[model samples]
Target: MRRSVISGLSAALVLTSAGVGGALLAPAASAAPASPALTTGVADGTYVSLKPTRMLDTRGSYLGRPLNAGEVYNLKVNGRGGVPSTGVSAVVLNMTVTAPTRAGNIVVYPKGSAVPNASSLNFVAKDTRANLVTVPVSSDGWVSIRNATGQTHVIADVQGYYVGSTTTKPAGAVDYFPDDPWRALDTRTAQDGPALAANDYLIQSVSYGANTANISALAVNVTAVNPQWTGFLNAWNGDENAIPNTSNLNFASRKTTSNMVIVPVTHGVGSDGTTPVLNFGIGNASPGTVDVIVDVVGVYATGDGLRFRSVGAPKRIVDTRTSLGATTLDAATTRTVTAPSTVTNSTTVALVTNATAVSPTAATYLTLWQTGVTRSAASNLNPAAGQTVANMAMVGLSDINQFDIYNNAGRTNVIVDVAGRMDLSPNLASGAAPSLSTRTAPKALGSRVATLR
Candidate 1:
């Protein structure tokens, strides 16, 4: 069995003869599209990081808060088949920008195809209660993403996905962070007023390979106001508002946590803790955009109130509407793992599904996916297919519950053994994990329960 499309986190493979083919990375536009007209030569402080935590308004709108992990709430938007993370996926990047600085949404596919097994999510939010989620159709749909506590959440919304291929170099290896500042391509590029002017846009896409090279280290795209223009930029310093780069970002497909770095800034007396106040830094960068590479978890989706999931072995991989099946692994939605010549300590887990793989369904092959999960009803609809009939660690019971592992016997390699518990319905793409109530009637797996994989 060939590896499916790839994600960032790496895993160990125990091939049980699973056959799969996935994404083909395509080159990204060297420059930002005219519609968005990415600001070029933007100042260093011009860009802002997407907030991991957000405070919701009294009416359930996101208001930017320090959302610790346990305090998050997941509310499903689309409610397709099943949610990925217990019908409650957290929004990674949370930020509110001034008017006109709209959030962006992207429907990524493998090299060459405009349309694939894709899910659309947006970043633009109108307060925290209502957000415009990008779906396949251009007709903007609104969804809820947070609660009164200002905590981000996704619940019961399900959607499937397709993935593209990633090459170690050139094609699909670059990773981007939404929370970091938007920087000029290079310091030299920063000098061009046309490219780095206030509100001047510069759109960029780096293809981190889809495999082990899936981008782990990313440059936090931060934009600083030219010390000359610092005054013009800081005018909105009251709420920490910034020129947010709502660039679409995907989670680390594999095993890793990304660290974020920030430059020293002068917190404006007029600024809330939200916006970045211009400060002196290396090179005395007096307010122009300065780009620095930083570690990141992934991007947050703004469309239909998006959802995302993190999967890895040793660390369990959850299957939701967005989960890739072993069959119909598409180029943009799949992540693949390769067997090491000499098995080392690393063990990996690839997704394999049964319900979505059958015919009459768009999904024909199992795949490896990386984009944020979907949180919409149109995405997940089927009850049986969406339910987690068998959890990941199912050793042997039903063909549908079996995991096709790669066996490199004689080689001291780590093999992933997943428990085959009953998921109300499993789909990884939505990555909206299943909730207890969502799986009210668990499937009868005949007594034995699967365990740690």
Candidate 2:
């Protein structure tokens, strides 16, 4: 007897070749269709802080001299506990560019490619700044950090990485679905409901069972506001033991700050026969209460859909500061911006860009989404008066190859830098697949086997 599996989407198991009377088994479907990606509206955890370790510093003699102005450096990010040396799709790095001899910005992306015309960490001369950056590793296994405008030293600490197949899937085998950034949790005034006291941890669930099954992780913007004292915050999987030496965001007392975070999650039943959940933990390391908020932008999962492609460097896609020679976006104004056709089209579903808000008259935020859709009750970049702030935004696209940008408060200058894009096409040019291994003996149906192959 022959067994065949079929799906409503016209997917089937077919026999390719057989020897004599023997039946042949064809290759399995590359991957299953993924769920439509969207940002979840829920509170996943309260803010907690962890101590951070320095992983790399280009300024010190260890890695040689500081990065020359307008130069790029290739950095390795693997061999950690969460981010294995192999099977890593993308890495979550807390990057800081410091000691700039002149005013400029730093652009981080996949290595060995042209630097995209974008900035990741902006700074004035001698000022130090840090941002949580999620960068896909190049096929050759490194990320590029470029210094734009002036010479500067770069520092990066490993937080985590997105993992993919241990068997046949290549690095960056995961697909991304971007949601209109939505506020999933806000402790201030109990927006999404849970509040936390000092030194407490809260578990949050995002897209566990309702929208899609088998979600391995999420990409989110975590914000901390109104803390009683200076402290840091940690975001991690609820089911795993806390990694005590890492912090996601560091904030001053009574201030509002946000950082992008990539958190791994548990799915389905474990080997112990207990159901698992996509849980996140927020630990408050401050001495007093602090409100926490999360805005989900995207998710990472294995599927027969779009996967990420690094453009080698960050590219400046839109700059509203000079749009039609207009320097500022007036309050309550909405602008339709067409993404360059080179970056998006019918096959591209989402884009990853660094959205910056600078010199606003009043506290303002920027909302980004596909053109023609109802504006989501979410924002991508929020900047305070007289301050320049940038946050990475993962935006979805429609057939129009356009997205809308709306300013929620007083006038502000906006800058959009493209880091990469996600498309439905697979990288068929990646060369030959690794050889496969076979089992010599039959195994029991319910039995478990452990082998490297």
Candidate 3:
């Protein structure tokens, strides 16, 4: 039997003065010099907040000219947010690309490389869109953003950074685990069944037994559907009272939209001690109600089996649109896609691909899973009739070094760009076993539910 990808919030606008300004702090004297090979894992999920600093703008003479089509802009990431240039691995940012003269997408990757065929944001001509992006910084502390269409303006606001070491350790001693996409919270049928009221908030606990053990953060895809009014969604640690001006994603009233977020989990736990729970506060930033769906794509823990590695740039790995010697995938059909040997190794567990569907004849969603395995109940990308839609999918690979992609609706041409991969090797040399005494695996919730109120 094929595995099914099971299908699966908003609150108020209390304007808290969370300023987006900050001075670049000098690197800590005691801090180790940054290393290109070092990949440090955050066990306690410690993230230092930096004032949302603007790093780039292509409009209004910030760059002296609007970004031209196919142009790449390099932005320095080191020394921002108190992160020194030498030791940083990844940075958390709120990136907004706007004012495009024509419809196109942007791809963000490390500097000094070819632009990956992947896309970070897709916009209509002259429309602005923002999304939370966690991108890897190159050893030189720079990242590159490529504009794929007409001239446009780009904005990046720094929030935090992750530091890692270069040594080797046991497989499961990393900071994040990229799980097969799992639906954890669905507000439509939750106790708060229905929609999140305007200016209201939803506090949801994300705990999935064993999988969430020692989890300090979660990499989730939050989707807002059937919003009653035009608004945005703000997600943060539920225990905090102040809501940052940062938004996960914006949506028009009655439209469905999704964005990726990497939020720190709360420190509370159940009696078993292993069931650590993270309080996710979802705030509705519009005047009406909206329903939210939360899906866990990965978790950051102190110990782990796989660590993330950012590629030099995103590359086109699969394009059923004829780029990779493939044909359009028909409705209700599954196609197996393989990564290049240069990209996949013995320890490779997953590949991050931006899957886009174009010219669809009907409404449908895409499901991806390891090859030879039943299709997961999770959907990776959704497309509407005669429209082009894209979403990032982190697909786990089976031993066969291939994964399956399934389209549930009309035949559509699919395009996939490989951005990065998660592998089983640790960055550092063998280290002491991570102390798991205080950590317990997540406890299963018979029916994953979210409290609506």
Where does candidate 3 stray beyond 4 Å? 1-71, 92-94, 131-134, 157-174, 209-213, 269-276, 323-326, 427-453
Candidate 2 residue runs with Cα over 4 Å from true position: 1-54, 57-73, 78-92, 97-104, 110-116, 123-129, 134-139, 147-154, 159-167, 170-173, 180-182, 189-195, 210-213, 267-276, 324-327, 425-453
lDDT of 2 at 111: 67
Cα shift from native, residue 315, model 2 (Å): 1.3
106-176 per-residue lDDT for model 1 (tens digits) = 22111222332221222222211111121111111112222112223221111121111211112111112
Best by lDDT: 3
Best by TM-score: 3
lDDT of each: 0.20, 0.57, 0.61
1-453 per-residue lDDT for model 3 (tens digits): 101111100011111111122122111111211222335533222233343455665654456566777777777878765555555666667677666799888778777665655676777776656666657777778887777778788877676665545343322233545555667667777354557778777666765444444555667777887889877786766654455655666776666777666766565666466555666667777888888877777665553334556655667777777758256888899888777876677666677666777777987877777776556566766555775666666677766567888989898888777666666534322321111111223322222223222
**Once superposed on the true structure, which residue ranges of model 1 sit more than 4 Å away at CA?**
1-92, 95-184, 187-195, 204-345, 348-453
Answer with 1 or 3, whichever has the higher TM-score.
3
lDDT (tens digit, per residue) of candidate 2 on 173-202: 344434435555666643343445766666
